[model samples]
Target: MLLITCPECGARPETEFVCGGETHITRPGPFAEVPADVWAGYLFHQANPRGKLRERWRHQAGCGLWFNLVRDTVTHEITSVYRMGDPKPEIA
Candidate 1:
């Protein structure tokens, strides 16, 4: 069982949150001008990192706010959690 630290409601079970995929994704400016392969890559490609990774998460059962989570993919340990618009603190 993994404990997810909710930015608004403190630490809670991982079940209370939902994974919302990568955080920093930008859409192509001109849809028609974008190549087929580029569009496909943007839609389908994702990095499944092993160590600490930055991901977007939503507290579905808690305060219901979307936030950034820096977690360890290997052990499912959350290193840091913060709101999307807030500045991330220095991690030791």
Candidate 2:
């Protein structure tokens, strides 16, 4: 099982967290100004890469806080984890 480290709590098993999906996804500028296609793209588009990727995970069983982590989609090797609003890490 994946051992994810929560910012509020300590390390926990993957079962305690929910994989929210890929990170770095921004909401289209403003709700009212966004076009239908653009808004739909923003809501439905997601990257399904095989290598290193950044994703969001929530500690559902622990602190209930959301955070981001850089992990490999192929091997599931996590490189780093950070808070929600923090600057994106340089994934190498």
Maximum-lDDT candidate: 2
lDDT of 1 by residue, 1-92 (tens): 88888878988888998999866678775998999999988888977777777789999998998999888788877878889987765534
Task: Give the range where candidate 2 is weakest over 10 consecutive residues by summed lDDT.
Answer: 39-48
lDDT of 2 by residue, 1-92 (tens): 98999989978999999999999988888788998999888778788888999999999998899999999999998889999999999976
Write down the TM-score of every candidate.
0.84, 0.90
Which regions of candidate 2 are displaced past 4 Å? none
